[model samples]
Target: MKKQRANDSGWRGSPEVWFQAAIEILLESGVDAVKISTLAKRLNISRTSFYWFFADREELLSALVDAWKDKNTGSIITQSEAYADSLAEATLNVFDCWLDDTLFDSRFEFAIRSWSLQSREIQSEVKQADAIRLESLSRMFSRFGFSDLQADVHARTIYLVQIGYISMQTKESLADRMIRIPDYVKTFTGEYPKQNELERFYYRHGYKNNASS
Candidate 1:
């Protein structure tokens, strides 16, 4: 825990402010680094101020897990349920999450997964999130007329690949990833996205001219 001035004379940070600071520490140095004293120094507030927003460290940690569930898992469920005219379009809608940080926080996801390795509770939460996300994806596929078994398999394929990317922290240039998007979509959905659909996806990601189609 790095030391800094605890300028908590009159300023008390809100829950969101405290949570964001904790998230920064968690992402930068893992969960163990997210201490009240450290956060106070980081936020320039008193260590006691943390209690104004949370009962204790465990409460704050619980909030972090809840936020992870709401953001990452919730994003997947939302995207899976988003309307699309075709399976390819539906798959692309889900893929939008990978390209858009506002929709999916990959670094946060990676950090939570890493934290799960040390805590059985977090590990269970991760497993539950995975099952829920997979079920949502399966439903997405089922909506396109796939049988339950086929939908489950395809959903797993799509999800496991993305999880592999996050777990491995795979890096690829935007152009490189863009070049592969169509094929990946095809592989996931068994249908290549049409040129117009690709354009829409690219535009949504602010890469309108990057569409291979």
Candidate 2:
């Protein structure tokens, strides 16, 4: 047998590379399909390389959970904390996750939620994440002058809507979603966003009006 190189695909058999491959497999074929041999074959590297990073399959699975926590939950909280002049802007910042994948991986969210069905540990983690997200959103609303009760309610509404979208695997074109954002902002915040705020958001996310289309 030919000796396989460690640095195939310029990845150097890094833990992140393994985690990324595992996540891809998890998304495509569920958690059970994320076996070590499958990943080594998929990456075109030796299975031994995996041992250097992870002790076993369980370790890789734990890394997956941590990655999802850090990437999806952590990113959204950071976005929520970003400076915004108004509640509308803060809401828009949260909305960016729905419009963008780099900040929030809806697929990952769905995968973990599915995984949670099979394991109590994952279920507890998901529950904690949900609470943290809800708290962050509620604080955003409170900062915008909503009463504590109102903020919590609004936060739950937004969180549930987003979760529903992910759970149902809803799909909408970027333009269609873009058109509805203003209405969503208005409904969520009880005020339409300012023109400049809307413009800045569009520019930041590269949304085009495409009037002719």
Candidate 3:
């Protein structure tokens, strides 16, 4: 990951690289190591190259959180429509996405959670994002005929668990996470876990098997 430090000039690459680098360094090292210069160096670009996409550090942070929302919340909410077979399937799909999506990976969630300690803007964004996510869960539960207030309480609990679980470093497989998440969802709504293998939620995508990074 060693590279030349980017100076604010060219579009070295997509803003995604900077966001990804910021999360990686933030998790592996800490917020102190997530500066624009650090990201540029990580990407083998110039520090100033950051400005080609983001105006300042705060903007980069905001963009990171926003991208996180798109992956963890927006995509899940949209795909929730296709999850008509069962509520357990839908909820697990969202929870599994938390682990599988690069935007909500352990690196980024750990970073944003740490960065939120000082940045009120990021705190607000995080709160807003969580609320939206809970709402999506609530709506999904209601679609399965769960009561409104019950859905709200259950959704909040499930959402918190999903986020908390992200920070857990386990030797479990993506399939294990996919298999286990349904227990949390069932706990939240008092719904029963899938009794048959056919009804269990299974992830259909590949998690980047990042062995070296």
Model 2 pairs whose backbones collide: none
Angstrom error at residue 167, model 2: 0.4
For model 2, state the Cα shift of residue 169 in Å: 0.4
The global Cα lDDT (0 to 1) of model 1 is 0.90
What is the alpha-carbon lDDT for the whole of candidate 3?
0.66
The global C-alpha lDDT for each of the candidates, from Candidate 1 onward, is: 0.90, 0.87, 0.66
Model 3 TM-score is 0.72
Across 1-213, the per-residue lDDT of candidate 1 in tens digits comes to 112245642587677788899999999999999999999999999888787768889998998999999989999999999999999999998998898988889999999999999999999999999999999999999999999999999999999999999999999988788888999998898889999998988888777463243
* Among all candidates shown, the one with the greatest lDDT: 1
Report the lDDT tens digits of candidate 2 across residue range 1-213. Answer: 123356653544677788889999999998989999999999988888888777889988988998899988887798888899988888888888877788899999999999999999999999999999999899888887889999999999889999999999999987888888889888888888887888878877898766523
Predicted structure with the largest TM-score when compared to the true one: 1
Clashes of each: 0, 0, 11
- The RMSD of every model to the true structure, in order and in angstroms, is 4.3, 4.0, 6.9
Q: Ten residues in a row with the worst lDDT in model 1?
A: 1-10
Stretches of candidate 2 off by over 4 Å are 1-12, 210-213
